[model samples]
Target chain A: MQIKHAASAGTLESSDITITLKPADNGVTIALDSSVEKQFGRQIKAQIEAALKALDITAVAVEATDKGALDCTIKARTIAAAYRAADVQDYDWEEINSWIN
Target chain B: MAELRRIWLTIDHDEAAAWAALLTKSGLAVDHQVEVTFGMFEGETLLATASLYGQIIKCVAVDPAAQSENLLAPLLQAAFDQLDDNGSQHAFIYTKPSTQAFFQSLGFKPLAHSDEVVLLERGYPDLDDYLHTLQQAKRPGSAAAIVMNANPFTRGHHYLVSQAAQQYDTVYVFVLSAERALFSAADRLAMVKLGTQEFSNVVVLPTRDYMVSSATFPSYFLKDRADLAVAKQQARIDAELFVQKIAPTLGITARFVSEEPLSPVTAVYNTELAAAFVGHIQLHVLPRKAVAGAPISATTVRQALQNADQSTLEKLLLPSIYRYIKEHSSHAN
Candidate 1:
């Protein structure tokens, strides 16, 4: 389902990422802000793009503020924001639990 | 003099990368508030570097080869000059454990520490200043204090302070000093002052760095990062600062807080504080005041404002706070 509204999840806390999203007219516009941008900038961008692709979000505006979060946390937060934007009351637990299991 | 010249690095400076590399190598990240940076140079090489961001002194590094008994004080003195010139009386510095005692000698008290670094501060966080200002104003009896953010100063806040006012001879309400919260510190403090004016014996003061200021904890943990290990260390540091410094300064017999049915972070914080302060001071975890069977909370008030639910906001907030914050929307910070 296409995301219809703006939503955000996670926080700017260290070892976490706060991902905010809004509907985009074209392809996904990804903007990243990270403390470790010098070292992990490319990797963080790639990870977020991958997370979006996995969630079947073809087009959206993504603003990610990362504070040294790992790949799993990045994916989890992105998925959460996407779910909220899609107006889903319940999350796909099987997909979420897969991150841990 | 030529061998030990001080160099200031700016983003456009030729050696900015070298300065950042030095900090990165030292297990430190570049501070966002990269104001004026000072580096000690020996001819063609950078020997030592320290960056001053506002009153915070961070991104410090001294080349291992340049280590000596007289390395730090001169560098710090230069930074202190800049701070003093800017009228900054208090400053905080982060340094490795090995260097804690060195800074302590210069009158910088250790605030908190983890396995990696310890935070030390000088001057401005002076509990003495707060005491002097409040000393004559202190009512003649046992006083209980509570530290609150009072984001928009909801009735939930009123209920807590009202309870404190009734129970103690005086209530010292220390509003959170950090302006990191959504409701600007100015707005929150103003609303709190207006809302609590009814309590004759209540005096509101900024918590400053005495309670849980950003300096008292790892900056990450203060940013809502839930690391229990870090939280425990930070809590111990805060509790000790309260017990040994602020409490003694204010003559506080008890500290009151609304019980958390909402935040897990607060739950851990209150629990840890209680455990550490068992014999020293009293911790009052008051039950949450409810309205129509639901807990009255600042979060609820903020939600009401966001949804444009005037009736919910009316029930959640007092008239004074309503007047100030009715049109002003805020979010959890």
Candidate 2:
């Protein structure tokens, strides 16, 4: 899905990550800010990339501010932000389920 | 610990006094011009507060007595969310030097700072991106810059640009982009471009809220003289931003400014600007150009336009600028 507008999801609270997605002419670029950047930054970025791959999104800019979130939380926030940026209201549950399974 | 509830101070007036007291107690002056204020309340007390003024975030404070030390993160997040909803992709904040590290932890990078204040910004298309665009205009020789509002683009402005162009290899004219002046930014820019088109080394560009803008110097357009101290502080910060970020980007080694003898506020700003550029960049203070025994000024041209004195305008402005002003006199204000 092509990103249509700028949208954001999640919160700044502990154990949650805030993900902001905006349309970009360049390919996917992630600006990740986390306290654990020296250790877990790569893993956090990998999870976001996996989520975007599942959604078939190739060109978008992401700003993720991580507050010690789990992998599942990162995936959920990325998916929500991608959907909002794409302006797609209906969730493709079966396709999402296939990615999860 | 009682759960903190998010409240809007602009919509709810009852908590306004407490918010003011909190800001004052935190050693911050209360500015009433902020557009939106978000407060985190616990029962009857205010715990944390942050405000959004246009794209700028100001007057952020967290109660010292509050249980959680992490109130700043949430407060800033709410402000950013409001800024995003308002369709602003970038955010700027002016805060004390002591709090720089705290803000940097949350992805805010420092743009420029003095002993008293530090300017920080978050989001894309930041200062580096701005400097990259300026890099395209970079010439090989020693360069000088002139920043002007040029409200009506008078002959004095022409003299300043002409003088700088003759002295330096290249002259970059940064026109103030704020719309609070009598003439619109576009009109002012067009006038400057036309006035300086005679010089091959002169390039006119908008300041783009980076120099002499409401974000950098809030009191520049405000007529109130009571805030002279605030105006001086803002002048220092604005000069530092120029010296640290802008001048080096375009290899500007000298700056030209017209002597401001009539306005005390501008005199103070000139003092602060000179002090900030000490030992870093050369400052040239040129005498104001005169016409028919009187100094040429945009204010004088504006007064003449108001009274429909075409003779005074003919003497003070270029022929082309005078014609442009004559055509747009209806919307001059």
Model 2, span B13-57: residue lDDT tens:
778888889999888898886888877777788887888888788
Per-candidate DockQ vs. reference: 0.01, 0.40
Model 2: clashing residue pairs?
A: none
Report the number of the highest-TM-score candidate. Answer: 2
TM-score of chain B of 1: 0.76
| Candidate number of the best lDDT | 2
Per-candidate clashes, comma-separated: 1, 0
Residue-level lDDT tens digits of model 1 in B1-333: 313344556534666777777777776666544577777766666767787766777777877767763555557767777776896657787678898876765546676554556767865425545556667566678999998888778888899999989999989998887767768877888888999998899998877765766656444224455566656666666776677667766689899988886676677678767876789889999998899999898878877777878899889888768877754544421
Q: Residue A36, candidate 2: how far off, in angstroms?
A: 3.4
Candidate 1: residue pairs that collide: B90-B124
Query: What lDDT is reached at residue A23 by model 2?
Result: 81
lDDT at position A27, candidate 2: 87
